[model samples]
Target: MSLPQPVPPSWKDLGKSSSDLLGKDYHFHGAALEVKTQTPSNVAFKVAGSRDSKTDHIHADIEAKWTNKAHGLTFTQAWTTSNVLRNQIEVENQVAKGLKLDLATTLSPEKGHKTAIINSVYKQSGFHTRASLDVFKGPTFTADTVLGRDGFLIGAEAAYNVTEGNITRYAAALGYNAPEYAVTVHGLNNLKTFTASYYHRVSRDVEAGAKAVYDSKSTHGGVALEVGTKAQLDSSAFVKAKINNSGVVALGYTQTLRPGVKASFGVALDTQKLNDPSPVGPSHKVGVSFVFDS
Candidate 1:
């Protein structure tokens, strides 16, 4: 069998600024008008530079997505390109009819990064197994299997990161899963960075989680903690919020207005960035989003 092509570089800044977190379920076709203010998100929307964005980076982009479902197979692709604004493209294809497999690819041309991931799942007589391989500038391989009935599951996985025929990082995890809660511990960079996280379903409509991170490396400034919660307002609406010890808070919400139509709002504030107070005030962002499932 032949393997898939390699991926481009992936970065956080390339994915977040003026982001659209819409999932595919309807035929969406609509554009968003960002009402910018003196906010950090607004500043990030400007001209794309090499590994950093230029000031006054505000611009407009037209994003359109199309999805097709048929014969137990589904395919979806979206593109956002512009000479005046930033460019992003996404493509996804999943086959879940008889055989079970999924392939997702994301590329950022301007940022010079791409990623392709292939996932395969198998279930038989209450035993579940999943295998995944990711291709980027480097390859990451992981395989997981669990045994149980109902929602209770226990599993372990081993992962390896390779670069130039050398092992850069090796990691393993032990996890338990239930209907309402999950726990896992992960170590990375040969235990240079360690993390443990727990998540639980507090109620039918509310879920909460917390994470603890420890860095053996001195450059990370030691330990950090994060807590977050997600709430579903109704069939078509939801809200999420999270905060970290660094005095950073992020809030986001989404609501479906009508059939095949959705809208959203988000804001993020960081107190650490507010030191020395520039004319734009503390680094903050306030924006709106829209998605039309036509």
Candidate 2:
């Protein structure tokens, strides 16, 4: 007998459909640039910078990654302008066929802070699981699992604070995915918030998605709704637009300038506050990002 196939995705990705449509490339408050290059010896380097329009502050980061395909190992080191250094090492399918391990550490010299985390993932036919533990400070532990068969999936996640000896987080999600569409619902933050999301491929060049979130902790127990759509203008270009319950609209346009180079432009407008007088003047924000790879 043949083995069953693994599930489509893990619990953390249950809302990926709405996330991609409503959040992808829609940077409406800052400008950013990124450049990446790889060497022949399996070393890759990346440099990125972003500028906040309101504060006029520029933030930058540099990262280097090395991968060894033979050993199924990868290492990454990164440093940011905030004086924080980070390192991560990953091993895949080494100790076990369907297991992966990751170790990550962060150090902040200016703040005299250090932290570490370890993560493990195991996957098998129709099931997937992940666990992460913080080896520093409160030493929190989190785990999540997903089970799927016939395009339907159910998952749950929880976190425990070892130092405090209490459960800090808990959530559950279920989803159904098909070639043409996907739908997911999640109860998050110990059931304090509930969200539902849907994605549909309307046509060969168009996709639509929507998300609804209800928060029990809100002053009036309100619900927020957002709907978005994406249209592929061509193989190298696409446009997206979305609007939310608060009369805020966002539009994004992305294009591949050339091989290994891409650029995106985004704008946000608040319809209700368009005529309001303020120091910032207009109730709109614009952002752009460029990426280059070699």
Candidate 3:
């Protein structure tokens, strides 16, 4: 019998549980639509468009991907109305077991700018590591690793700027994950900022989470906190709400229109200035999005 492979959190995912619960799918100033389709030739296509409330401009993007599951290879291409094109190629478990490689390049035709990055990830029992290098723009290098055992995780990351000959960024994280709850603490931006997050599944239909941040470099050097909750109203609908220390409240509701269609609505309001005459004081926003998969 073979033992199960240990799963460790990626550097960017150290506080993903609470982060996702608090930040995901809560839009305040945009209306968007997306369509996704799968083709018989092992290809997938996605088209998305959005109208930005602030800019009053419509933006769109088209993306396509071809995947070969047998060989663990994937290729993706994307183009946006902003005159930028991106290409990505990924290989998994081919160079070595438990290893993955990714190469991505982006081109901005109008701006005549191009950039490329190479990344590699390796995972094994009780450990996970990854590294990336920018082929352009100072040829910076970044690496992160995590060690995990019994749901306890510790991870650290660092980045070096080749041109500057210095370490530009460093961060560390500690986390505990359980079947019903997860908690994480991170020292980020060279330990000048600290964050702690917690997530709990109260029941099958209810979930709650919170996040707090203390930034020593902030102008006020104060702690900021936000708490959020998600609840399934029924089989076809769900709702989420969150409030921050600044008296800003946001709420979102999502419903399944049918088997392949879904819609989401969200709003944000400032509680402190609900009756203020000025628009800057009584700020409010609304957003809506629709998705179709076929």
Candidate 4:
């Protein structure tokens, strides 16, 4: 359901074209606190929080997830409790806790409430199917099916909004996949989005990709080009870089620190305003992250 479309512009984004803002900005911070855990038997939990220095504000959340994969059956459930500290978005402060509650939290018309969603997937030989439903003020249901083997695949998805009393959106995708290269094309019926991506493995430890996306119903329409590469430096370290034609460049590095700890750092720069005499605001950011496991 190519949902979350027609996104509102960023706080102070300077992109002249509507397509420039088609994608949401990745949330990055100079520092933050995070913790994660997983059990041997399909259970996991996470608690994370961070503050915005300039705003003197904090956002925090706790989430728990468990999946059952025994007896040829797959079922999963997740629950979250969030404290959206900012008053910027009325709903965020009121009912946006546990953000991943799916259609209820994601697309339900009703705002500021607890959300619950369930999903189950079934697979056999050359086919797989998934069904999901969310409990917000009203239930929204989604179903998707795919048929494919090792070399090729195709799928379609449809979602129904019970609260809105109508079918919300539909999507279809086709792709070809192999060990060395892959390509895919997909579109959303609701948002007028067309996206295609291609990837190729240059060797065992290096791969590159290019993606093109066009969407809009606003500002006429726009397109973006992104190219990226990831390469393994050794057994426990790697680096990644991406350049977007619109105006940004980013690079990241990750390394394992110990048996169960990992660290990462990244930076993103807006190339367009880097040399401008009258810059609107901060044009770059650096972020640090750490993960620990039992």
Worst 10 residues of 3 by lDDT: 276-285
Clashes of 4: 2
Query: lDDT score, residue 88, model 3?
Result: 98
Decide which is better by lDDT, 2 or 4: 2
- Model 4, poorest ten-residue lDDT window? 85-94
lDDT of 4 by residue, 20-100 (tens): 222222234565567888888876777766666446476666656555433222232333234322111111111222122
Residue range 1-294, candidate 1, lDDT tens digits: 544322211111111111221112111112234321223322222211111121434445443323233333444343444332222232223333224566767767677566777767655554556666788745877665555444334444555565556554454444555557766565656666777777777899987887778988868576788777778899999888777898876787778888756777666667678664552234655455665433
What TM-score does model 2 achieve against the real structure? 0.96
Model 2, clash count?
Answer: 0
- lDDT for 30 in candidate 1 is 21
lDDT per residue (tens digit) for residues 1-294 in model 2: 655766558777886977899999887778999999999999999999999877889999999999999999999999999989999999999999889999999999988999999999998888899999998957999999998888898999999999999999999998998888999999999998999999999999999999999999999767899999999999999999999999999999999999999999998888888886762335778899999999
Q: Against the correct fold, how does model 3 do in TM-score?
A: 0.96
At residue 35, give the lDDT of candidate 4: 83
Stretches of model 4 off by over 4 angstroms after superposition:
1-28, 37-45, 52-56, 64-112, 163-165, 189-191, 276-281
Better of 1 and 2 by lDDT: 2
TM-score of each: 0.56, 0.96, 0.96, 0.70
CA lDDT of 184 in candidate 4?
71
lDDT over C-alpha atoms for residue 223 of model 2? 89
What local lDDT score does residue 190 receive in model 2, on the 0 to 100 scale?
99
Q: Arrange candidates by lDDT, descending.
A: 3, 2, 4, 1
Every candidate's lDDT: 0.53, 0.92, 0.92, 0.60
